[model samples]
Target: MSAGPTSFCGIELAHPIINASGTFDAIAARRAFGDAVVERFPFSAYVSKTITPAPRAGNPPPRLWEEPAAMVNSIGLPNKGAEGFLSTDLPALADLPVPLIVSVMATSAEEFSGLVEAVSARDEVAAIELNVSCPNVHSGLIVGEQPSETEALLEALRPLTAKPLIVKLTPNVAAPASVAAGAEAGGADAVSLINTLKARPMFAGKPWLGAGSGGLSGPAVRAVALQQVSDVAAAVSIPIAGMGGVESGSHARDLLDVGAEVVAVGTASFRDPLAAERILIELRGLDPVAASSATSEL
Candidate 1:
């Protein structure tokens, strides 16, 4: 048996099965599923969706489209933003069974740093997962696409944050592993990845998603996720939070085997909100109870 508890950035997780941010909405989900949802929170830690400086209505209509064995989304990180997140959302999610990692994004490095400082002050926030995959409005360079940009962004925010800084990398890059290395060079405590492959869906001879392009996620991306995690883990010294298409215990274990420290369930939660819990149960079954209860003849 592994000697230590499944953890990420020193936060002990009851299990490695954590819900991917944007995929699981704890408060809304609880309201929908009631006690059933509360019974199995479906994650070792809860990650809030991307928060910005102010509220957003999100992209126009038709933000989601279904494809075979996967889903495409251009929801555009629609959220209540920082002030509303702290005042309204955090309080409600304060009682999650595990730590709360807040995911944040912005248009510039300074904005990213500001968001980090704001969320870092919260008592319930365990860590800050910086979404650097988005295109930077100021320079038009995705921080995750260029190693230098990622390094600079991390360097700017690292000093402002005491909590673990997790840089979420975009899979749309030519070499995500090199980007992950850049994050580590700038003092990122950990990294999470395969943040949705850039994709588009078509139906009835028309674009299926409102934005014409969305991040593709689900079972279809699992193999790519595994490879990226493996490459990043080999390239960096920090822990990797492997995510993308993990939907079951075997899938989670496959990630761990590939050097992922924690497995994040994304699209699976959309289909079965209880998938994380089910994965945890399956992981628990891998070790016999006797491993910890072997009788020693004195």
Candidate 2:
């Protein structure tokens, strides 16, 4: 059996598999592996690393700690910022065979509006994903943790672009469903979840990461991803991109069964650069009919 095409927010994709933002760096991969990396690019749609208004130096190391079937990271979304990304990276990323979704973060609605306007103005960007994990500079409240904040942020950003706005929900909240509903009410075209669980790994009674606490990812967060995806699905009619510890075909299928329209490969890519391709092959083999059915619904 052969798999059919899938679409997210009006953008047609060859498959339902995509890369989690920040997990796969196409530019570095191309430098390491050359054109083969682009010739057989793994993800259906490529999501860029989180970008800010100004360049970020990122968090101090030790930034990573290995755990059983998981890893904690305090990478702090290092990027060359919006200007540098547009001037340097966007050209190379635009050359890839897949549509591009740019992930962005800001501390205020005003700042976020600027990012949306600038990024959407470029023809290379197929959509914009708002990374709502940070706190609002004015309210000092995490935008994704509170439904009101998420709704207000969406409302502020909705008018900036005709492109799809995907709200990347943080999993630390008590009820992610409410936040998802709020995003929908405020004009979000879709939502993606299970960004990573908060963790404080200790080494010799001292915090291992320089940031003290970091976000955990890998096979350890699969169950949490499913439950949150299920809850968010029930609360909104918008499409979903579910991810967290998805290392196999069965893991991807589980997220789809729960309600994710697309499954993003994260930590598995660190283990194998072509993990998304392997997982997509396995997914087609496991249940081509189910994959086809899900694509039809999308």
Identify the candidate with maximal lDDT. 2
* Candidate 2 wrong stretches, greater than 4 Å: 1-3, 289-298
Model 2 per-residue lDDT tens digits across residues 1-298: 1234688989998888999999999999999999999888988899999999999999999999999979999999899999999999999999999999999999999999999999999999999999999999999999999999999999999988999999999999899999999999999999999898999999999999999999999999999999999999999999999999999988998998899999999999999998998888778878767565654322
- Count the clashes in each prediction: 0, 1
Q: lDDT value for candidate 1?
A: 0.84
Structure candidate 2, residue pairs in collision: 218-245
Question: What's the lDDT for all of these models?
Answer: 0.84, 0.92
Q: State how far residue 218 of model 2 sits from its true place (Å).
A: 0.3
Q: Name the top TM-score candidate.
A: 2
